[model samples]
Target: MTPGARIAAAIDILDAITAGAAAEQALTQWARRSRFAGAKDRAAVRDHVFDALRRWRSAGAAGGGQSGRAVMIGLLREDGTDPAQLFTGERHAPEPLSHDEAQVPEPTPARGVRWNLPDWLLPEFAESLGAHAEATAQALQSRAPVTLRVNLRKASRAEAQDALQAEGILCAPNPLCATALTVTEGARRVKQSAPFAQGWIELQDAASQAVVAALPSGARCLDYCAGGGGKALAMAADGRTTFAHDIDAGRMKDLPSRAQRAGAAIRLLDRAGLEQERPFDVVLCDAPCSGSGAWRRAPHGKWTLTPERLAELTAVQDSILDTAKDLVGAGGHLVYATCSVLRRENEDRIAAFLAGHNGWFCRLEQRFDIQQHGDGFFTAHLTRVKL
Candidate 1:
């Protein structure tokens, strides 16, 4: 398909998303219907769709309307691309811009539109981030970098780099963690690369990998909220006795297979089983949140989050922390983590926990700001002062 055709496809998908269809579902439906579109065409179209979503408010302002055509035009303009070229009336291209449509409008001074976030969230971001708010907001307007976590048990950093380079997957070490690698090129080929296929590397954000690295060492550990078991698998690479548990047991169905691939022994535990196993040396609670920090990868989440939903999440985070504390053995560590930059979910939650619980005290707290390479993340190590 021509570049114009790809833009047109993106416009349609964006319209579907605006009409309440999920971004992924809309993209999938488009791909299934347009079977003639090749792999490159599909990828290009998907990129356009996500880019538009990431800057939806700004694009709408620049394009002068909420329609898919106008938004696509706005997105192209934002990227400094000539909309006339892609909106040409050529075969398979979008319709030519009308006289009025050609006159792109200046973006509104509204903070949400300018920041490409919900209006209510602007103040929240400001309150949470303070001086760094604008930088964090701007970072979410683009794509996230592809990163990988080298399975230390399977391959050394040098060996993993060599294997990735052999398969045309260029990478460089991430400063955040020893096991982290920033994929410099050929990221699309990583899943099929020899290193990744053989479990030498696992796709994970550098910040996420750093969270595991900072965890207190213990002979026995439990991932209290192990969704997909990424951290559990990371912890297992060190030959620790690892156990995984989640509120929703179904979420861990694939963990056994993933553990097998990584050559790590991770015992999956249900609620009953978790109760049976009284306490662990270390318990990591990678709780759920609004996912504001990693919005670059899931831009739809930024728009969909509401104040009520955020309140609900904070309650859940508190409950998870309180429950996970019980599973931490005497003098053991209970780590709380979230992929959110908002204070209500990160530091605020920690503060609340410390206030309510008498015996626990925070040992270490760190926030990884969203950078050109890594997603926003916050983690805190809490140890019982007296047990």
Candidate 2:
């Protein structure tokens, strides 16, 4: 498909999203119908849709409206591209811009609009991130880097890098963690690559890898809120007797296969199983949150999150910590983590947990800010207070 055709496809998908369809759902529907579109065409169209979503407010303001066409126009303007190029009236292209659409509006002074975030989130971002809030918001407007964590249990970082490079997947060492490799090229081929098939690497954010790397020494570890078991797998690779449990056991249906592929042993536990395997040396609670740090990968989340939802998430975080604490053995560590940049979900939650749990005290706390290398993350290590 022509570049113009891709833009037209993106406009249609964005329109569906604006009409309440999920971005992924709309994109999938379009793809299923447009069998003639090639892989690159579909990828290009998806990129355009996500790019516009990431800058929804600013794009709408610049284009003078919130329609798909207007937002596309605004997105192009923000990117320093002339909308006329892609909106040409040629076959398969978007309709030509009207005179009003062609006029570029001045940039908005409102921080929320300028930062491409909801108005309600501005104060939260400011309070959570301080001077870095605007920069962090700007970072979310672009695509996230493709990072991989070398399965040290299978291969050294250098060995994994060599294997990935052999498959044309260029990579550079990520500074966030010794095991991390930032995919510099050929990211689309990673899943099909031999190294990945052999479990030499797993797709994970560098910061996420760092969170696992910072874990204290322990013979047994339990990922208390293990969703897909990414951290569980990582911890298992460290040679710890790792166990994974989630409230929804269905979320870990594929974990056994994943663990097998990575040559890591992770015992999956239901509530009853968890009770039997209690008193672990370390317990990691990677709680769910607003996912603000990962908005670059899931831009729709930023738009969909509400104050009520955030409050609910914080409550859940607190409850998870409370429950997970009892499973830690004497002198064992309880780790709390989240992939949110908001303090309300990170430091504030830790404070609340410590306040309510008298025998626990925090030992270490770290915040990984959103950058070109990785998403924002927070981790805190807590242990029982000795009398």
The candidate maximizing lDDT is 2
lDDT of 1 by residue, 37-149 (tens): 99889989999989988999899898999888888999989999989988987878999999998887866888888899988899999999999998899999999999999
Off by over 4 Å in 1: none
User: 8, model 2: CA deviation in Å?
Assistant: 1.1
Full-model lDDT, candidate 1: 0.91
Per-model TM-score versus the true fold: 0.98, 0.98
Candidate 2, 2-92: lDDT as tens digits: 8888888888999999899988999999999999999899989999999999999999999999998889889888889898988887979
Candidate lDDT (C-alpha), each: 0.91, 0.92
Candidate 1 has its poorest 10 consecutive residues by lDDT at 104-113
